[model samples]
Every structure is written in C-alpha cells, then in structure tokens.
Target: MSINLSEPIKIVFNEIEIDDYLPSIKFKIDINIKQFTHLLTYSGEIWIDCKVWDRFSKGLNEGKDTTLNDMDDIFIIEIIKNNEFIEFTWSIKRKDPEGNVMTAGYSSKITDDVYSVIRNEFINYPKWW
Candidate 1:
C-alpha cells in the first residue's frame, strides 16, 4: 500500500526474537514510505548495547542527520532534516548473480510528523534483555 508523504511514516518490527544468552535481537523491519514498502529481514545480530535506535532518536529530536545500518550492512537508513521537510533514504545491499554487489534505495521528502513517528518508534522500542 502507498503512504502519503503528509502522513507519518510507518516503521514496525516484527517476528522479534531475542537471544537467550546474547545481548542481541533478530527481527524484520517493515517500513512504508510514500509508495514504497519493504520488509527487511535481518539475519545478523543486532546488539542492544549499540544503542543505534537511541542515537536515531536523539538525532531526530535535535534535527541532525542520522544513519543506521544492520550489523551485516544488509540494510541502511539515513535521515536528514532540511528546512521544513525531512529527507529519508532507505537502502539495501545484496550480492547479485556472479557475486556482483548491488544496492537499491528509495528517497523522499516527508513531513515533521513522519520524523516524530519514527523517532518515537526508536525511543520506545521494547528492550527485552
């Protein structure tokens, strides 16, 4: 489904599983922006102590640029605030046939509400330690 730029961007973490003995989490990030929707399944460990989400939240609150990537560098998200709009970029890297590395990304200018929603999503993410 397509999301309007005026509306808050959607970010959801699903299929969450925490490691029993490690401070790591495994989940899929389902993100929707404008007309693009992607479900990124992260097979690599996401360390809780990294505080990536917290950094994103702080950056959003302070109107600064923030870039976050999975441990394996499979998924990357970048957010930059410009004037009254927020520039958001989401990219994925994968190896194509013949071991060729390829990257695909989508970018859009969104409203402040989108930034707030994303910031809260990170700030309130459950910490299941």
Candidate 2:
C-alpha cells in the first residue's frame, strides 16, 4: 500500500462586514482541503480586529510562525515554517444543540509558496467598510 499526501490547503475570504461601532471586521471564511479524490470543506463567519491582520502579516514577513483565530475562538489557523515546507493547520470548534463542544481540524505540509499565497490573499481581500 502507498501513502497519500494531502493537497495544499485553500482559503477563501467570502462576504465581509465592518462593524460601525467597533474596530473589527466580520467576514466569512471558506477552507477547502483535497486528498486523493476526497474533498473536505468548512465555512464559518468570524469577527477579527483590523489590527490583527496587520500584525499577522508582519509576523509572516519576519519568518516567525503565527497563529490566527476569530474573536470567538470558533476558527483558528496556524502556520509554521519547516525547512523548505510550511506546515498548515486549521481547526473549527462549535457547540452542539446539547451544549457539548465539538472540534475538528486538519494539518498538512505544503511548499513554501503558501506564504506568498496567503500574503496575496490578504492584500487583495475586500476592504470596503
């Protein structure tokens, strides 16, 4: 039997809403991962302070590992550089109707180009308030 490696993680920024009373932006995030012929997807809405994005970018530029999460802890993304590859991890947490917390996540290692992909996405993200 042969082992299969997962595809590079994909992140898409959907609709965005800037809070009028706060320095935060609320937006929808869509994450997709494909392994062989199987596709896994997760989408959720999260609010994040405007400054966090800037800080995240700076950290990446400095070659430091970084982790970003929504204000509510509902979604989280962690990126770490390992030699010539980047380790990407994402997780989602939610509560069932019975109030029990459920969590799911996935991690993969992809080419260092992932850093450029993320930077481009953030730079071109919707900015209308």
Give per-model TM-scores: 0.67, 0.77
- lDDT digits (tens) for residues 1-129 of candidate 1: 111222344555553466566455565565554554544332222333345656665786677999877667777779987677788887778776799986666787877777776666665665554
Tens-digit lDDT track of model 2 for 1-129: 111122366666555577767677776777777778988787777887767766666666776787777787778877788667788788989988899997878887756676666655554555544
The C-alpha RMSD in Å for every predicted model, in order, reads 5.6, 6.7
Off by over 4 Å in 2: 1-7, 123-129
Model 1 worst lDDT run, 10 consecutive residues: 1-10
**Model 1: per-residue Cα lDDT at residue 88:** 85
Highest lDDT: which candidate? 2
